[model samples]
Target: MNNPTSGTPAPDGTAKPLQERCDNLMKRIDLLITIVDRGKGDKIVQALRDSRVTYNLSSVGYGASGLALVDMLGLTSTEKDIIISVVPEERASEILNILLYKFDLDKPDKGIAFILPISGVSGPIALKYISGLQQARP
Candidate 1:
């Protein structure tokens, strides 16, 4: 469960809901998660490392995302690392809850993120693992 992105210095920079209706003309996007916490966010990073179902791109949160004061936009998420992944429609909600609760995604400025539509995935095994993690829930 080692996270390769762990300890990696982020540029110090930089979603939506699982449901809530998206635009019919807009393209479906992948699930992108940006985790963060004030003081030290390494623990959350380690937690993601331990239970990650999928790992895409992870980088340090900074810049505008860090300058964010409210949680509506991802600007407030720059305090930590951003993890992006692609998950199926059915599995998106579960992943959201995990980040929101399992990872406390709703901690306001603590660091919040959202998921969008995913067109496709390059790694099916990785997708399966992520879906498996969602299914193995409490």
Candidate 2:
């Protein structure tokens, strides 16, 4: 029997180890995730660009507050935009500030943003695309 589920085969029949496969997904990167009202994704993306955070992606999604809120609104779900961006650690704070102050996220229901720390980074192509590596300055 060919144990296809065991691992991912590169080219030949041999399966790549799980650790090796996971390594490809790791990157010394931090992710900034923002959830905003529908049609507000552009604002988040613009802020990232303004902060020089070049690598980012935005998508539409639905937000569920809770059963009570859902009942109060008489709606099933609230439309929202989810923006994900891979940023360097040093720049995360500044980008977040722009999204908060400039975009008025501090106000209620304006939306929220947070940063998730990444442990390890791999994949040459992704690294190149993100360009997250920082050159030491004197």
Which ranges of candidate 2 are over 4 A from the true structure? 1-28, 66-72, 75-77, 132-138
* Model 1: per-residue Cα lDDT over 1-138, one tens digit each: 323333434344322222211211122335656556543345544544555444555666653543334545543434556666654556567656666776555665557767776655445335445444435434
> How close is every model to the real structure, measured as TM-score?
0.46, 0.67
Model 2 over residues 57-76: C-alpha lDDT tens digits? 89989887758866687775
The TM-score of candidate 1 is 0.46
| lDDT of candidate 1 at residue 78, scale 0 to 100 | 40
Which candidate number maximizes lDDT? Answer: 2
Alpha-carbon runs more than 4 Å astray in model 1: 1-29, 38-52, 63-79, 121-138
Candidate 1 positional error at 115, Å: 0.6
Which 10-residue span in candidate 1 carries the lowest summed lDDT?
A: 18-27
Give the distance in Å from residue 62's predicted Cα in candidate 1 to where it truly belongs.
0.7
- Candidate no. 2 TM-score: 0.67
